[model samples]
Target: MRKLFVLLISIVVLSACAPVHRFTQLRKLPREYSENYSIEGIKAPRSAAHRKPWIVYSDRVENAAYVNPGGRVKSAEVGLLDTFLVIKTKGDYLRLIKYNPTNIKHNRLTQRKKAEYVGWMHRSRLILSPSSITDVQSGLHDKLLTAITDTTAIMQSATYFTTADSLKVFGDPELQNQTGVVGIHAIIYALKHSVDKRSVLVSKTPSLSADKIGEQVIGWVPAVMLQEIGHQVFTGTAFSRVPTLQKTLKYAPMIYPYHTDSTCSFVSGTLEPVIDKKDNHVFNINGKRISYTRGNQIKQELKRINILFAMEQSSRLPEQYPMLLNAIQNLGPFFAGSGESFSYQFGAAVATPRGMETIPLTADYEILIDRLVKMASYVADTENTPLPAWKAMRSALELIGNTPEAVNLIISVGETGEQQENAPSSIVKTLNEKNCRLLGWQLYASNDDKYNNYVLQLSNMIEHYAEYRTKNKRNMILYADQFCRSNLLREAGPNFLMLDYPYASMTQGGFLFPEKGETLPMELFAGAVDSIVTQIKADHQLLSESIDRAFATVGNGKDRLDSLLIATYHLPQGVKPNK
Candidate 1:
């Protein structure tokens, strides 16, 4: 009876000891491997409500070497988090070993070769494609995802714990000598095993090999579990019983499993499929036992859950749908703003028999302007509205306006003589009457069939204004930019022209003399007139010289004149020539 009792006792003791032996012998993963492996947790520096505990681990020291290759060497002590495994080495600098659970398995380059190739090809296509703009947009999206994932991985592994606390937990004499993970590792191991009662699981089943079990855990388990374990290890007060923490009187691991289910619902539920009337028989069994159908469902669900969890943790997948939806929502007003700016800068016109015609205040131009005015009126309403497209268009327009060549192109288009007859008579009459305020008149003559005749008419109007309309001939001289000198000479005869030489007088006389009884301030009036004359001279010279230069460079002909006419008519700031 005694022998039998002893035998039973022996069996129980052996059974109790089996798990540790199995764990230690199972593959004997290097400490470095286990230490280096990690998973990203909640973002740091977050609000208390947003903060989450970080969790990381590795199967062997060598596995950890991939993150910090110098075989568990000590790195510089960081002020933020004390002792940590050195995972990266550069020059004399070392960084803590970090791991991203999502990319852990993806570390194999061969497996990702196809994806890498495709990505490279896609980028190349973007650069080489005809529609490079669209390609750039897509590439930006992809790049954003990649950057977010990479950044999240780095952030997750960084320790938030202090060095002093770590040293107290590790109790390594060398730590006092050098800032390193040697002490930190000892503490982590002690906390994990002794305090948390969370021994690394080892396979005892003969059929279930250690590698197979590790694979199962790594592949099938959700990353959130690691986080949970980490949380328990870091915050639990159970480790104070250990010799290292007992002396220091520091808090130990606070192993609470509450709210852990929130991280991974599928795992918490044990991968059980939702029960429905149609699938009820999946659980059916002979009256004695449940069958394997439900088990299969559970297994399948578990597999799916594992994959999704891994993907979520590893890739840092963006809330793409939400971001894109928000971006779209923000683009509406931008487009509206762009439309307004476009109409304002480039006067819209209606198609007419002669050609496309600018609408005077009463026509389609007026309607378009009204729409723009309305949009501008509501600028306060949509002041801060996000509209990337509108912003982009506005930027483009601004760029175009800044370039002299681009400005010239637009002016040429506006001045093209083919569209003159389409303008409102009020506008033409105002110009024909030589009114300085109605400066848009020059743009009308740009498209006329008899451009020279129009020019002659303009000169005649200016001459008439000089001779009869104003006593000092001030208005004609002030608005000299409105008349085409070459055209005037060709039609009205050079002898009939009285050029107001403002600069000649200024240079010849010590000061400009006021005419008798002038009380409106002759100096100010003369100064203004001189300025206008200077601008008119420069503009007329530019127009004639540009025409002459074009003829000299390209050969004198009607084509050169035509080109010059087009060029002059398209001046920026409208055809007023003030600019």
Candidate 2:
């Protein structure tokens, strides 16, 4: 009986041991398993296949990678400018594998405490290049450290690092001389600091030297030993572009089909009460403007206006053409009644024989729209993608003339990719010489990576151009998407603005109406559109009132017009005239 009991106990113990052994095997499996874990089936990002090296752009500890997507197990911590190779990507997450160039073997405690240095990080935490790191290291700022005393020993693990007197130290000190001068000072950048703020991991500056040693410099001294360096702060702001009443009407069809004539009349009278009527003529004293108070006699002033619409027109025109026509139709009454001749430039191509001549707004509204549509269509079909922006600017300037009488209002839609060729200084000089106030609109019609990059680059270019001069705030740019706004909006906030394209069904259908049964409320959409139009109309009327007062008080209509342009930019909420 006792023998039988022993056999049963043996079976039970073995069964328990078998499961534990399997569990141990499971634990030994690689952390980045393709078949299991949170990163299962997660492929690399479009750029990750290239295995590009990225550097940590931020200095915060939270900008770190983990063993898994669950983020429970932190494999390693990276400080500002620590670079690692991007091996894989899953949505916003990137798998970073940082190889410790300094590979020193350690025993027991020290080895176990060593950081893994290979894990998954978020894309936002990384910058594609190491320019910032290189700049700081090579800059005039001092970034070196020396042992405060001869007894100060180097450490192997930052976690267990100590500066106390001891017979034996858990680190290497080959770089330190008998005089306590550590030759690694200038080359050694303080890579990372410990949690207790007492120790730091030091490594050779990759930009300064080609030497990769087996032993990384350890931190046996407190952080106080390292000199503090201040970083240059750059603040940029992105201003939101409030659409004109005419621009808002372009999206009216998506809400519900409506005649352009009827909508124009409906919007012309619609006004939202904001500032007082007395406040409307504030621009007369500050800048030049047009007025209608002259009783049946229209003030005939030479007004130079140019519109540049540079879309990737080949593939985009089919979707955008109708809206463009609608917007132009709504703009007819405003520009036509202004008693000033206006010229319209369309597409990204060099001016054709017919396009070289300016199309006056005095032409019948319907005829004007038809001519524009046909012209834009021809230009898109004939010219290659992307309008040569600098050439186009020069062309517009030539058409408008550089004289003070020109007073050009150049509204540019989209920009070219040739940033260096179309330098900011050149653009600023061109605008100033032409007496032009530029208003740039960057369209983000798609989430395509290439398209997004193009728009962002365009935004940056506009910003650089705007920042190049402070004489006039009227030279501004508006972004179509929030992402672009967030990216560009910094300390220079006044120059950037968000131009909200209200038609969700057109731009963001997937996000707004995800399910088959989901339908947008047409009435609410129309109300929102009306609200926007009303506010825009009120702003437009205010500008008109200011112009009326300026022209009435008239010294030289041209000089007053110039001052009005400057005063218009200083409006409480500002205003964007119809394109």
Candidate 3:
């Protein structure tokens, strides 16, 4: 009985260890052999192919290839013991496949530590799975770093890449072509220096369309050229050393357009001359004027004709020869009816031609030039002298002879107290007969006694002559200088009187006053004048009230006083009482 129990225990243990598919074939066996039948007609077990173990590093498994036998094996049915044994035999190969190029910790550890680990793997004692490794090489890393650095450099140097919605590239064809070449060269150079060769080829080639290429080229070329030129102009040299050359070179970039259009050209040649009828001189350059009274009709005509002739001649010359042209025509009518020699000289200079052309010898032109030259020379020579009365008279005659239409002669009179006492009465008489407008005789004022007496004598002689002309049906004007209150409204019962004041005040009084020292502030002087005007108006009102009161108190008797006040006030119409 004990032997039977031992055999049964043995059978039960073996059955438990049998393959699971053995039961599916039991029904086909004979009844006597069913419990102990040999599994026949089964296919011979295939010999296993040599398995090369691979270590694949993946997120789901850690150290699985080393610790687990069939973790990543191609066939899990292979004995787990056999898989673990195979992993051990090929550990070096597994390690090599699983090496991580970017393992910072492994790389940073001591060389001794790395060697110890490698040595264990070689001896098949240590295994590293493929999942722990990454296929990163030193050469590729260096290439990436270089590409990044190059891109940074390009971005830093690119200055002309603007984001404006609309850009104005100067539309000239020639300029655009030159700019294209420069821009393309610059961009290529920048790309060469800033990007990896491979990246530049890959990124910039096929993607850049023809339109984009042209726009970029055009935008950068002129910009770079202008920037370089600006630096040269500021720091490389002085302007005058090669001014025109420098200008020409700078405008080389602009020449394509400038040459084709008149408005675009940047050249100015010469200015035209202006003729001053009152001064009888042509203004060749600038700064010329003339003043004449109504009587100088002949001189005015001559002056106008001279200016027109000069302009006509100027038009015939090259346009570039004259940079500017300014003519003051018909200035003689402004002065009270008299033409002064100095005035005519000034007019002639204002109208003088600027070019080197042979001035046409028309009789009018010759006469105008002769008169102008004579007047200019005389004024230049006699500028400092006190013009004698007879000499002044002769100068007037010369002016009238040169300009036949000259009907009036204006002269400057001495100040109220300083008339030319020795002025010949006959000179004034002759001027009155000729209907001359004498001016500036009243302008002379000085602290000097002799000058004052001379001015007084001159004024008296002028009055005598004016009275004679009035009786003879001829017109005459005695313009007195209002240098002081005494000269303001002289009772010189002449047909015409004009008050002349100095345009500018001088420490030592004269027409062209010199600045001797600091002068009063204009604001203060203006304020003072305003105050004076207010006082004057108040005083005039008081005077009018007094005249009205007197008229009411003595109706008929006040007539004489009213007449006296009217005369004193110089009122054109008689004063009336208030309603």
The local lDDT score (0 to 100) that residue 57 gets in candidate 3 is 18
lDDT of 1 at 271: 18
Superposed model 1: Cα runs more than 4 Å off:
1-346, 349-579
Best by lDDT: 2
Q: Ranking under TM-score, best-scoring first?
A: 2, 3, 1
The digit string of per-residue lDDT tens for model 3 on 1-579 reads 999999998987776553221121111112221111123222222222112222211111111232223234422221101111111233233322222223223223122122212111221212112111111221110110011111122223333222111112222212221111222112121111101212111111212222233222222122222211110112322111335644665536333333554333332221111111222221111222212223244223323211111111111112211221111112223221222211222222111133111222222323444544443333323223232333433344334434343224333222222234555656656555544433332222345555445444545545554445334321111112311222222221232223222121100010111122222122222232222223323322333333333222322221221343344345444333221
lDDT of 3 at 520: 19
User: Mind sharing the TM-score for model 2?
Assistant: 0.28
Residues 400-452, candidate 2, lDDT per residue (tens digit)?
Answer: 54332423444443322343433455656665555443444333234444434
Please tell me which model should have the higher lDDT, number 1 or number 2: 2
Candidate 1 residue 481 C-alpha distance from true site, Å:
29
Give lDDT: candidate 2, residue 471. 30
CA shift at 373, candidate 2, in angstroms?
3.3
Tell me the lDDT of candidate 1.
0.23
Q: What are the per-residue Cα lDDT tens digits for candidate 1 across 1-579? A: 999999998987785553122111111122222222122121222233212112222222111121232334422222211112222234433332222233223222122212110000111001011100111222210100001111121123223122211211111211122222212122111111111332221111212222233322211111111222111222322111335543343343332334454341121211111111121121111122222343333323212100000000000012221222233234333323322112111222222122222322211223434443333223223223222111211122222322211111011101112123343334234322322210111212222354433334334433433233233222112224433322111111211122343322110001111122221121232233233333333433443333323222322111111222234234232121100
Cα RMSD (Å) per model?
35.2, 26.8, 39.5
Each model's lDDT comes to 0.23, 0.35, 0.26
The TM-scores of all predictions, comma-separated, are 0.15, 0.28, 0.20
Q: Name the Cα RMSD for model 1.
A: 35.2
